[model samples]
Target: MKKSTLALISLLIVLCLLFVWAQNKILNYRTWFRVEEKILMISDRPEITKIAAMGFDGLVADLLWIRGIQYFGGNFSTLDKPEKRSGMMNLLRNLVGLDPHFLAAYQFGGFIINESIKDHEQAIDFLLDGADNNPLTEYPSAWRLPFDAGFIAFYQLKDHDVAKELFLQSIYGKKFAAVSVENAEGVKDDDSPEWLIDGDPFSSTRFDTSDGVFSLNLHDERQVGRVTVQQDSKRPKSYQLSYAADASMAAWQTLESVTNPGFYFHDFEPALKAHAFRFDQFKIQAEEDEEFSIAEVKIFGPRNPATPSYVERMAYEMDRAAGRFKAALDQYMRYYDEAVKKGDQVSADLSLQKLFDIYTNKCIEILQETAELYLQEKGSLPTAQMFELIQEGYLSRIIQQKITEEPGFVEDVAPVLMPTGNVWEILTTWDQKDPHLLITYTNDLGEEDWYITSRTRLIAEQKGVAEKLQQFVNKYKEEKGTLPENLSDLLNEPWFGATRIYEDPMGGEFFINRETGQVEARNPKY
Candidate 1:
């Protein structure tokens, strides 16, 4: 063989060896990436890492995302212990840093770490970062990232003002977005109710300024958006809505006037310092035989419903963090109700779910506390008085109205208590065992302009089942000198004025645990 040919073959062999060595090195680094601590150490400087990726930024981000999912999914069983998921958040942040448009990383990672690991601050940071980095052009009509951040601010952080601000940013681009009509608080005047209508049909006083005046009594200075009037008579007449900065002032400026009036809808720019408003006049009045009646009057404006003052936001957060549940409950419930009344379902639902969570979690907490006290004081499980104590001590009046009695209050702010066996039972049984159950319930009816606000309906039938079961359990203990052997024992002969107990709403058998004296809905179809 020629010497030149032999040298060429040797060079080729050397090149092949070098290629194999480089491949092995790459594989080693890939393996190291799977190790969370190593990922954390390497990902400490994301910009530097991105630079090192040699312009394959998206590819690098994808690889990191895969690793993050593996880490999250593999060890999710240990989610309760956040320490076990130490490097999960770092992995996600690094993933997003490489490719800011990797929205899935922001969404899943932000929610997972925040909800499961209880690192809400980091989760909120991820979401806010995504909101800032990914604009509407790239992620068109995508408001979720900012929305997620807003949720964390309101629900977890309990900062209402921050939540409101973030929510507005999500809906409207941060700069362009002012609080729109959907979010603005409803302006209601206490005296405005009495002034809405006056006098008998024959007297012709409904539209007469001397007899009665329709007005809005704003609690504070707010921006007025629109006013709607439904006249009882089909006859066309000119109607003018007037506004005044002060309720006491006689000077009135006409906000809107409609000549063709069947269902009058007048949209106008809000007064910057407007306070009180009233009906100016009704033109072309009907004869004494024809009575002018106004059926409904709806005034909409920018009342700033969910935007709490700094003091209120701080108080709520402090109370929630310190575990002052009743105070926290009151604050949350009021916010939820107010938001609903103002037609801000987004804020209302968010706050409503938080209220339920607080209520359920707090109830379980107090149950445990009361149970512990009973165990210490009387020993064993509690009796009738113990149940009574649970009702009175822990649970508040839970104000619910079947029929709304308050005048000028059109919306019903009742709790939308969905039928579940006993919420407390669900909490105790499935505290963190099932994460999906913790998801907030939405308005199944529809999304917009709900006459009855989207609230969890507390069904009477299901409530009876829970309460009856509790009574039966205590009764069994009293009569038999121990807990009943089975639920059938309590079902025997007119115990609840019937042979069998009430069926579970989910078409399951009502289950009673003899050991714990707790009731549950078991054997659900799905």
Candidate 2:
């Protein structure tokens, strides 16, 4: 063999050995790294992290997101530790900070913080930050963040006021207008009820009888909130407020009863939707041949241009969320059947329990809303029978009416309550003015189980009452050419007639803001 050929072969052999050694070293390093647990260390300052990203924030965010998922999964059992939770949150913040449009990361981080870490305030703040970062005009899916925040506030924190605000934010635009009024029961004459809604609070509608009725009609079904009634000298002794969805005036649901009525203003939380409202059972303190009159009847509701599309969007998002859960439930049921066929009892049990959870949650969501309406109307939680009445058809009718009246609702079948064997039990004590519903059901374990649903009714009753009082103050000033020395002076007037002028629902005192001459609550609920 030639010496040159031998030298070339030796060189080739050396090169092959070097390549094999390098490959083995690389494989060993990867194996060692995989075995060792890695810690997720991130900068506390998002701005610093964003600066370091060098316009590759999106790519960095993606990589960090994957690392976050792995870290969360691996340390799932230890997430209860405050340090671990903090680390996870920091990583999430940095990831989102680098890429503000990383909506999935925001949502996932919120869920983990809420469900695993049980840090409600942080979760809310994080989710709201996501909502603020993504404007609804630019990213329509941004609504989900606020909706999720509302869910956390309502369900976890039990802060209905905050939840209501968040829910409103999620829905975006909701503008109210004055609802139209007409004479429904009173004698038809020139002094018709139509004059009550003529924009002039002084334009009077005279009724000859002690008892009279007026109807409020809206162009479209709207979520009616504020209703202000101004009396012309002779106020009714009392009145009943009710609503109906049709012109027939059948199936009217009573909203409220005012025992001592004068000038009244009420703002309903979680406003009720209907086509018409009725001021019935108006009993005036009348002497013989004396007539009472109503100066104005103002009903405020969401009837503006933006309301229709916003409302539709809200309903659609809610239904979409429900649909996702339903799809998951259907899949679980299928898996349960498969598990049963395979005789995998444990898997079947797990699937069945999951199905029950999803079903119960969805039912509670619907029931909670209906129960709230009942509470708003009756001023108390529904009894079993009352709840049954609502479940049977009343709620369905209200929903159907709303859907039918909406401009773009064209579904063949209106959503209705599905029949379930679960029983609703109302639990309350003598001291518990606001009670809750306990739903009893047989779970997958074939045992009696219950889920409790409760919520606080955050109504600004005093706010409305104070505004009405301020109106009275303005009237008193207009009449006497001076403000009353005290609220007591106005109560002494014959038109008011010793009727309790203002009582705060949350145990606050109504006081006059002497500077602005506006009535204010000492401890405002809102």
Question: How much is the lDDT of residue 310 in candidate 1?
Answer: 34
lDDT of each: 0.55, 0.63
lDDT of 1 at 458: 26
Per-residue lDDT of candidate 2, residues 1-526 (tens digit): 9999999999999999999999999987654443312245556777988888888988889988998889878666656566576678778888998888888998998988988888899899999999889865467767678778878987798775466556656655222344666656664377767777775767787765545787877766666655667665522356788888765656789989874333555556557677787887766665645555677776654322322233322332332244445334434655577679879887778776666545545445555566656656766555532455346554555455546685322221121123231233222211234433444446669886544443222233445677778888998999899888888888777776556656654445777778888877777322
Where does model 1 exceed 4 Å of error? 1-35, 40-43, 75-89, 177-526
| TM-score of model 2 (CA atoms) | 0.32
**Per-prediction TM-score:** 0.34, 0.32
Candidate 1 structure quality by residue, lDDT tens digits, 1-526:
9999999999999999999999999987754444545534555677888888899999888888777777777656555353456566566767888888877788987788787787788778778888888764356444678777877887888876567556645533343112211111222332223323232112222543334345555645655544546554445567666777774646778766766434454544332456666664555455654434555554544323233333234434544665645445656666677677779887778776667666556434434555555555655544322344335433222221112443211121112221242323322322333211111123447542111101132233455677778787788787778876667777673555656666664335777776688776677421
Evaluated with lDDT, which candidate comes out highest?
Answer: 2
Poorest stretch of ten by lDDT in candidate 1 = 448-457
